[model samples]
Target: MQKKSIQNKDSLKRFVDKGINEKELSPFDPPDAYNPLNIETIPYEKMHPFLKELIDEHKNFAEVLSKFETALMNWKNNNWIFNDEIDIGLKQFFNFFDEKVPLHNQKEEKKLFPLLHKKLIEIGEHNSVDSSITGINLMEDEHLKVAQAVAIVFNFLELGSQLPDKRSREITFELAYEQGMAIIETMKLHIFREENILFPQAMKLLSKEKLDDFN
Candidate 1:
């Protein structure tokens, strides 16, 4: 078992050194239909209070993601050497994801999504074949994917750091980098979808009273 594990790790290292092909990376690319549903840009002051808070959270998250990306790039370029700046960036990234993401998701899933689902169904915007198939479902699915990607990145990095061999450590770090990119890309798109499509639709479909409940 140990020999097989080492062999598999070495193979992965070779694959990473060669670089992932465009085809393998395509799945991580944003889809063609990733545009916002709303054409009009809603001003911050005009946005619902609930939405404003969520958007604020997104802005902060985006900043952290940008820093995290830079840290990842620096780490990779420096041959996976850890530094104080890189260490802080990684810590912030994981900390924000662990502390903030779940509560933010809960605000959507528990507060907003159920109401949006009902409104979407009433307005015939939901999938006809399956009422459960809606934009909300997609958002929820992406939430799970984000969590999974973060977990993979965290686990791979932690495991890689403990590995005795340089090759194994490098391979695992490379894998973590890939997963980290997934988290960043997926999150940007997810936020875009919510801001443009989901939130706008909620504002339009749901009543003022219903929306106020979010506040």
Candidate 2:
């Protein structure tokens, strides 16, 4: 009994060390063999251009966010501040990311989701149709949360025009930077959920014949 308990404890420890929980591993897997960008099963070379573009865009944004976060952290710690031009650049980037990016997502939610739901029903599965509708609605709600947070960042940055000194600029910069970072984190998880969970399900339901007309 003692030996069995020791082995079980070791097994659990190994699982934790390997990050082998169902929630962690399941999200990384694709719904089916048709998805070329399924990271767990497919190599990068095998990915279609569309899927490659999607992944590349997400990764590039993540890199930019990391750089901005680092700059903000350094500013906070060492007081190595930025000039007006840098402040303006940061504000512009936040505005573009928050405003323009969500338009693409809104397009997906408004146009794509209903069409996808219809396609699933045409394929003869009521369950799939219902599931897609529910899932896509939830995803759009998440997008709304991120968009609202981003609007707050944009509004705060606009107040920079009223800032009197470099000290106030620094303070405003930090606030905008933190708000943008929070929104970026939400956007990252949103991308992960869509690409990993939603898109694969879509691909499985949407046949080549059905997608050809849209393409």
Candidate 2 Cα outliers beyond 4 Å, as residue runs: 1-60, 78-80, 84-92, 98-103, 117-133, 160-174
Instruction: Give the lDDT of residue 146 in candidate 1.
Output: 83
Worst 10 residues of 2 by lDDT: 9-18
Q: lDDT for each of the candidates?
A: 0.74, 0.53
Query: Against the true structure, whose lDDT is highest?
Result: 1
Clashes of each: 0, 0
What are the models' TM-scores? Answer: 0.82, 0.57
lDDT of 1 by residue, 92-117 (tens): 99999999989999999999999888
Q: Residue 107 of model 2: what lDDT?
A: 54
Write one digit per residue (lDDT tens) for candidate 2, span 25-119.
22222232123233343343554444455556667666656655565555456563556545554655575576656655655666456766566
Model 2 C-alpha RMSD vs. true structure (Å) is 10.6
